[model samples]
Target: MTHRIQLAGHRWVRLVTRLAVVLLLATGGLVTNLASTAQPAYAHAYLVETSPVDGEVLASPPPAVRLRFNEAVSFNERSIQLLDTNAEKLAIGTPGHVDGKANTAQVSLPTDLTEGTYVLAWRVTSADSHVVSGALTFSIGHPSATAAPVEQDAHRAVVVVDAVGRALAFLGMALALGGALFVAVLWPAGRSDRRGRRIVWSGFVVLAAGTVVVLLVQGPYAAGTSLAGVFDPDLLGAALSTRLGHALLTRLVIVLALGVAFGLAVRHGSPPATTGTATTATAGAAGAARRIVLPAVATVGAVALPLTWTLTDHAQTGVQTWLAVPATSLHLLAMALWLGGLITLAACVLVPAGRRETSRAITLEPALPRFSGLAQVCFAVIAATGVYLSWRQVGTWAALGATDFGRLLLGKLAVVLAVVGLAAGARRFVRRRGREPLGVDAAPAAAVRRLRRSVVGEILLGVAVVSITAVLVNTAPARTSYAPPVHTTVPVPAAAAESAAGLQDASIEVNIEPARSGSNVADIYLTGPDGSLVAVPEVSGQLESPDRDVPALPVTVTAAEPGHYVANSMSIPFPGEWVLRLDIRVSDFDETPVRVRFTAR
Candidate 1:
């Protein structure tokens, strides 16, 4: 009978995991319908407006170039650069704020520039500590046939290493928070479990190491330099000055404090609190230290540790930040407690007690039920916060399929579902065993083995979820990252009726692809009431930034098909309200203007 139950349970577990994977692949429609409608108000920064639009042909150099972003951003002297057509670096003014606006950066241009096409490369740190960089071109004369290539993104290896460091930190955090909770609080023999103590100690070391790695690599990551810059004093100094650096530093300190508390909890959990004081007189001292000192420090450190992450990460920047921060911290705490506790439980209790291999009897009396209760609470917290955070980060239904962040989230949910399935079985076992006359340890050997296998599966799935989450952390939130292009058609101006015959019943159709920022191509089609292209004599274009307080920038519109006009290199200076005005010259004297208004992402 036990064998039959175990086999059926294993098969059921396998089926659930397979179903979870299939559901993940096809869950787009289901998730969108179920997703909450709350959208984040703010996110990462992108170039909103520039003094001179990208790809504009300027007769003379502008005195100063200003940049504006949709959100607050910070930059240093190294944030802006001028590169000539030949890829030679040129000196530019130090980047600073314009009129005390944190989102705007201004740098004086050198009057000596003789540019065929010069690339202005700018890098800035957003509130979330991610560095966004891009390059735009403005020609002094006509657009050059060939210009130097610009690499806007950070080095691939640097990004990968940074991600690895983050994964390690997350893993270490789980172990430190959850392992310590289980060994010191949940399991009765946790204090004396040699293997368990070692695991907790290893967690501290790994967490600290990962934090140090991220701290060092952050210099290169932000500066757009190679790995060699990791040790550069200036780069390191700049990194330390940012909010992310401060958070990492605080995290390290908290890790140290927490490590000390964990050490004391296990060492003096049943020992003299202090070193070398085992006497009865000092027993009172030990009791006070154990009962008062350890718990105080651990509680504070655990609470503060997640704050370091919440205060600098995605949670700190978006809408209802006050709420997001607390929710994210709770999410992290629940994850740490659940994952770390499960790993510790499986290694120290389930495996040994199931295999029945230990010389000392591994009792299941109170620890199993206690951990079961904690796990249940942790899962509840995880579900609540996960739903809220997912809604905040991924606002629209389209974004879930369009952005990298959204896809990663789906993958994470899949793995978590598999883990949840296994966890349900484990919880059921605990509940059923608790009601028996005999203790949980009296479970048949097959039943214990089945429980052990499910737990191992849960741990593996949990780690996979953590890995996906690490990548997700480095990606931009889908709410801000996904931007659809502009496509609209406006009726012909009334003046068109007096200007020409076909123009009376004709309309202008405009399409802009990937219209976020920088260079974009605008396609304009003149279609008559019959829905056919109507040729015009001449078309001249200008980009108007009326809302941004910038002068009109010339756009070079050229003929394509009969009535099709293409602004092959329409440069959008920023992501806000703008108009692409086309002056159509139908005859020698008659000219009418058609304006297409749109918003760039």
Candidate 2:
């Protein structure tokens, strides 16, 4: 009867191992390419247009300020602040979504506005639940009498804290998930190892603390406030109001449950007592009864934590959330399992051998091949999921090399490949060991040394991968860089013609397009006073808004058609009456400099 039960337990273990392998393979193949079809700009919210368009010099304040985005947004009135040059807040009504438009939000403005420049700074929740904010300045009559334009790095403190919190959370997840797996599967003897237990406990603590920090930082980040606001109850409350907040809160709850599972696993799976140790056989029997149960609970919590992470990040905002979220969550799990297990193996199994503990070290030899097999499965999943995410994130090959996010991703990939190569080396070492028993002897010790070095290399590379991943989460994906610029034609209402250098033979007719505070194409038509086309030696222009103390904007024109010269692109920095000085070279000997007033609104 005892032999039959032992055989059944062994079969159960084998079945569970087979199931895990099958799941990883099936998941990797099933959605390996799904993310490639997802939306290119996974989580970024773009401002399509704004009312009182950027740099508009309005004679009077508009009734309301409207901002349109390409994606649906969650409106927060308090997040939209109107400040004058002195940085004094203006009276603005609550913000609301525009009627019949899901992507437009507007805020009512006070009609009684004085003649001073005002800046509208806004933060909104994008469809993917990420916060996006920007500032636009428009003058009431003249530029506001205030301090010099403050560099926008005003929220650097909060950004740093947010990034730190993200890194901690990611690191914590790796430890907790990986550490738990080590104790549960790869090294059951780890149950008795002090380092292994501490690793698991430390992982839980780190993850929990990181989650708290992230929750605290989210509110202030969304509010675009300084570091002090992290403690603001109101701001924290505002964070809790968003879907992201709920996801974070749920993660905390899940972590709490995860802690309980770890505790239960420890209590129910206490190691065999050493000679003279006070631990009882009864306790061990109890542990044996509930051994599978505690690990199962731990596995669920591990999976749940990654799910919450996916819900609040790019995966959630991705075009195919259904596929991306699960695939990404699985990817994270695979990483955690592979990395965490290796860490545990090194610290508990391999590192101890260096201290001359050959007996304990030999006990770990059986687990090495098992972990290698698992790692192979994990690496496959990582590669498959990574390919899908790369296609989704980087859209084009040019962007992969050109964009910051893509560059970071490339760096991460290079390091991962190195880690994989090391892992392969370790696997080769494991295979060469064959069925021969390992010991404290020279050959086995050397083999162990080689494997440990490779494992250590992998761990170091893993840290780099995680650090880069934290930064990647904060970066705008490469796909966003591919968006085409908005180009619109704005006809210059004035047909005002200016003649060059005492010569009425060639007059310059200048027209600016979509006269706004961005790149605009200038059409300079050279014509005779008789309304006939005329050609000039060369044509160039510059813009200066004297009222706003703006500098000269250089414009280089090229001949696109006969008698018609066009500025490839010129930037109009502010909304006002800009003097478009057209330098028309009528001849090598004589040049005509003509000035025309261009209203950029």
Candidate 3:
């Protein structure tokens, strides 16, 4: 029996130690990748058109370069750069809106730019506050086969700090909103509990600090600047002009309001009263506050705080946005209340209750029971909203395992399930041990210790949830980010039969790889009706974007194998609907067009 007990104790210790290690590693490691991905920008804002275009051989540098995105984007002077063949940064004009359109940016190119290859590296913040970066190279006179790749992405330190700031903000929000609610409203003796109040107060301070950090870091993150640029006035101004800036500022105001409300709620050291006021006027004032004032402010602040996040994140952009926004807000609120409340409960009530036999024989009574009930409701809301959100963010069943976003979500869910299981066990302990009215305090010391350990596990798991959530929120949704390669066949034009003298039933098989913005490769196979190779005189193509009013870009198709043709350097300008028009010449004078339509990510 002693051996069994000893093994169990060791297991518990190991579990906690492992959790602590995981928390540290995940927080530090995952944040570094926020800005380093190659292309298919983090948010939906994609570059649909570029002046001079990628790979265009020009005799002279254009007076000004223009870029059009599918959606609004925010950038600063440092966001766009001219890089020489050696990956050296060159002088360029400040990036600005084209025709005063937020979706388009224009920059003046130096007329003295020498001949050779040059890369235009651009990093911009989408409306949802995610940074998407890609490089497009255009040659002044001719392409450089040996041109170096652009290494001008956001500095690693900047991305790490930015991610850390975001994580802190998420943690602080939970404490400010959830912790405050627990200290002021959940526990009866919470008002005077120094530790509990301190935790709640610290939450407000951390939240404010975190918000400030993110605000400061935003300037550099969006501009792809070094950490020192965090305080640059111009960078700061550029960041503030964005949608996320507005949201962050609104959040600060709400935090102040909520903090005041929490302070007032706890000011009445003695629990709220009905007959405590001596005079009629004082009584009436107290009654109004108890019934109306505090609740109104607290309610509004709680509801609005989540909106500040939901509105700015990807949540507000997709289908069922009206429903998505509210569901996400509720999901966030429930998370805060449950996590913050649990931490307070453990620290103020359960911890102080003590496992020592000589400790005060306090009845568990209302605090434990009330919180258990609240937790149940929170879990229900979390479950319902979680399901809807999962479906909304990851549309297909295969995506669950196929995409990074889906896999991360699954990891979060696994941790959440573990938390739920622990919470249930704790609930059972509370009900079973508290049945004698003396509460869990009346039960065996071993039972009480078990309860405390279970709560600790739940708390640790909750922190893990928040850390994963920090990374999860920054990533593009699985549905929007996942793009399968384009594969399809288009029928050969009838005009081709008259020249080739074949008859009918022939088709062109088209394949495009990593069909995203930037460099791509496409393979075209001319197959006969009998599924044999059939050589053609020439196969030339151009890409057309039907969704926009832009001109079709030329695509060079070279022969491969007997019947196969390859567009070895196809560059898709953006993520959207596109058509690859292949003009095949069966005979010199007789040619026909074959259009293979597909979507690019």
Task: Count the clashes in each prediction.
Answer: 3, 2, 0
RMSD of 1: 12.0
lDDT of 3 by residue, 62-177 (tens): 89888888677778778888888787888988899987787889999888988888888888888677888887777777777767687656788887777677777778888877
Task: Identify the leading candidate in terms of lDDT.
Answer: 1
Q: What is the C-alpha lDDT profile of model 2 across 77-188, one tens digit per residue?
A: 5768888778888789998888867578899999988888888888887755567777777777776655225334338877777777877788788888888777766776
Could you report the Cα RMSD, in angstroms, for every candidate shown? 12.0, 9.9, 11.7
Q: Write the per-residue lDDT of candidate 1 for residues 1-601, one digit (tens) a residue.
A: 4344444434433443343343332233222321222123266777767777676678898898888787777788988988887888888889999998878899998998775888889889887778889887788867677777888899988898898888889899999999999999999889988888988888888888888888899988887889998879998998988777877876776776677567656764242233332343345544565676567667667776787777677887777787988899999999999999999998888775435555778777788889899999999999999999999999888889888999999999989989889999999999999889886988888999899899999999998988898888778999888778789999888887667878777889999977766778999999999999999898999988777556687888999989999998887777788888999898899888888888887
Candidate 2, residue 421: the lDDT equals: 95
> How displaced is residue 504 in candidate 2, in Å?
20
Off by over 4 Å in 2: 1-42, 75-77, 85-87, 99-102, 141-151, 268-295, 352-362, 435-443, 483-601
Q: List the candidates' TM-scores in order.
A: 0.85, 0.72, 0.80
List residue ranges in candidate 3 displaced over 4 A. Answer: 1-43, 146-148, 268-280, 283-287, 352-359, 431-442, 490-508, 523-569, 581-595
Which pairs clash (backbone N, Cα, C closer than 3 Å) in model 3?
Answer: none
Q: Which pairs clash in model 1?
A: 48-574, 48-575, 49-574
Poorest stretch of ten by lDDT in candidate 3: 30-39
Model 3 Cα shift for residue 443 (angstroms): 4.0
